[model samples]
Target: MKTTAIGYSENLPAAHPEALLSREVPVPEPGPRDLLVEVEAVSVNPVDVKLRAGAPADGFRVLGFDAAGTVRAVGAEATLFAPGDEVFYAGSIGRPGTNQRLHLVDERIVGRKPTALSFADAAALPLTAITAWEALFDRLRLEEDSAGTLLVIGATGGVGSVMLQLAEALLPDVAVIATASDDARAARMRELGAEHVVNHREDLVAQVLEIAPEGVDRLFTAHSEGQIERYAEIVRPFGHVVAIDDGPRDVSPLKGRSISWHWELMFTRPLLETPDMIEQHRLLDAVADLVDRGRIRSTAATVLGPISPAALREAHELVERGRTVGKVVVHGWEEAIDSARESTDIY
Candidate 1:
């Protein structure tokens, strides 16, 4: 029951990262429908930082959700994965999580990693990709034939990047619009297949109006509450707007346009113990196939450190700043050293 883990003992925000540190703890065993993963790589998300600082100063809180690794053990009821299989998952919000050498994850929420990507790159995709995928395909109900002006707000960040690519690959006929204020970031969005890129700093409605000359059919918001309603202006009547952030705000204005509002929390199924938790497994498998087929590439923007608490805290800080262009990953020390050894002499 003993294992090596990384977590925080005190409550601290990303800005004050010393609060998170590595610790040795008891390893968790897989329960029915769970798999014990020997974690190879993990990624940091803004939620990790928020929960760390916001949560009560209880015992150690393990906060990572995105991970790639090998299965070391499987619960009696687990049939999807077996020992020695390479897997990746965005673990449930309710679980102890993947910021450790070993973790217990529901087998139904995991999938095989893309054989093409590195553990670090693969680690970066799960949480954000799943969030974007479910929001567009599941919540918005965007069909393969759902062609329209699709606008992605905050489109250069991790989730946005993957969402842009997913839209491009699956909905090829749909015109994609992305918001990015910076020149470099806007160019990146275009490279990822956004048909148009606009400045989030300026008037979003005007820019979108100019581009569409009509109205947007779908809007995916990753930024402010103000932006969500602003997007409502650009969406055609009865168009859909989906957001992953569930901050309290008024959506009254959207009602006038009959614009449907949706909230996507990739963790909802696992957190609520939904009967559809297995859907995450299916979605992840689908994404892995896309990755393998080169329809989507890893959006790993940075690699922080081997799985040390100090490194994770730093990664959280970077994410909190709202500046990282893509995903950030950290490897277990063994995997980190091994990666260095195997890489070409490029550094």
Candidate 2:
């Protein structure tokens, strides 16, 4: 087996946009209940870019969220994954991540890969899918399976893109009203199963009313700040709104509608070492089922080359630019190949 893995490195904060390097490091070992994944593909998120641009003064911070890979090994206590399962997951924010050739992830947070999708497409789903799933199901506290209109704030982003599909898969009869600032994005939202496409650049209230007229029952905000106050105005009395983005502003606007506001961070359970961290595993597995059954489609729109500092930096730049419509993935690494070879030998 290989002794080291390849990954991107950020040594210091960048005042401008040039402070990432690619290098090799020792391959990580799996702890109890963890799986050593041979990453086949990976995707970047906004958190990756922000953390890198404003990185803390430390050794280095490995930044990556979504990944699809084969399991190379399993910790003693790990029951779900073995040596050769194809899996996908949005690993913990508390540890070194999938930017490298091999990554150690808690088995409870990982899931079987969808047989229908390729590694790149599967890579796009994990982070965004988990974020969307938790926001709609966990934080919002919607029924395990129910139907109602769900308003998505930023439908073109990685999270919003997958969220739309999950909503559609879970509740096929429900109306999905998505907000996209432009025509291209609106089309993309529709492709993902949004019944109505509204413009966030205009009055959300007026635009939403034109479709439903009554009001939305649930609202999910995917982009950052400024729209909380607006969402508060449009949601029906006692409706729920869940936000994954951060803002320090007062949340008092929700008081008027008696609306419920939720903050969703996919990393919460893993980061805090919560008791129910395994729920992520369950949800991810459920997502895999939906994908394999052809109920939810992967939202990976673009595929880049092999994982490297330059490619990773470019991926981060795409997120920062706000023009990307769906998730982008990078594949090709020794870890994935080794895992495949081991699987063949065992078979």
Candidate 3:
């Protein structure tokens, strides 16, 4: 059997409309501990853009990270999920991605879908939510009772949207200050739970200092244009800063201030096959519970039709423009399901 997927034939720029195309490939079978998911929805992320631009010339390179779907089959050792389970996950970079009808992902990296959201909405949460959660709690070691100011750069983008809300929900004592370029973006940041929204277009150090005179205790940068020097200046001595962007940056300025720099990549565990890989499953499950309890809402701001090559290309274009306020999602498959066995799972 074959599955429909969207992929790139060459490393072409997003402006080239022919960069992405739909094609059929043989459906893959599951290995031990894998779940063969029938993809229902997917969200376009910055990683997708980078991968598409750098795609190999020899063959199609499938490029997606966030996905929500139903389990069509499970490997023998995959005890976490059975056939017909509703799930969401950011599949590993080492494997073929979720921009296809059938995707095989390790069950350890998947989570039960949030009962409160649609497939498209749930699809938006996995990658960004995991990044934000790991950045705050794991890298920064932030606690619920931690006191002092926290500065979030790029406060209205996909990762920033979820990070802001998670900070407010998880760290009640910490003051959440965000940086945005315009009034509209700043207001949207505030709506997401930022206590202070400063303009990033201006001197970020000065703007942050005006609100936090002593400097912030923790900093999280979702997107930085070589702003490590600015971060080093605005963060207090011995403060912690986490960055998730793949852009080149200089961290030498942070040495003088004794500030600690760390990186958060949501794919690390799955890619490395770490012993603690199951932590992603646990974290995602917790996030889903929070969403169900109304503590956090889906950050899906744009829904761009079904998961086809054309729709996915448009979604990638929006994300590449770098001004999207929240997550962009594409739901459903291009093909219709003819059997009840494939359509019964709903969470």
In model 3, the runs with Cα more than 4 Å from the true position are 15-17, 247-249, 337-347
Winner of 2 and 3 under TM-score: 3
Backbone Cα, N, C clashes tallied per candidate: 1, 0, 0
Lowest-scoring 10 consecutive residues by lDDT in candidate 1?
Answer: 223-232
Model 1 agreement with the true structure over 30-81: per-residue lDDT tens digits: 7999999989899988888778878764688888899999999999999999
Model 2 per-residue lDDT tens digits across residues 28-110? 77788889988889988888777776656256567777889999999989999889999999888778768877889999889
Candidate 2 C-alpha error for residue 293, in Å: 1.6
| Clash tally for model 3 | 0
Candidate 3 clashing pairs, residues 3+ apart or interchain: none
State which candidate has the highest lDDT.
Answer: 3
lDDT of 3 by residue, 1-347 (tens): 99888888988767677888888999999999999999999999998998898757358878788999999999989899999889999999999989999999999999999999989899999999999999998999888888898898877878888888898788888899988888888888888899999987787789889998878999988765577778878999999888888744678888988999888999999999999999999999999998999888998989987677788888989998987778999988644533333576641
lDDT minimum window of 10 residues, candidate 2: 7-16
Q: Which of 1 and 3 is ahead in lDDT?
A: 3
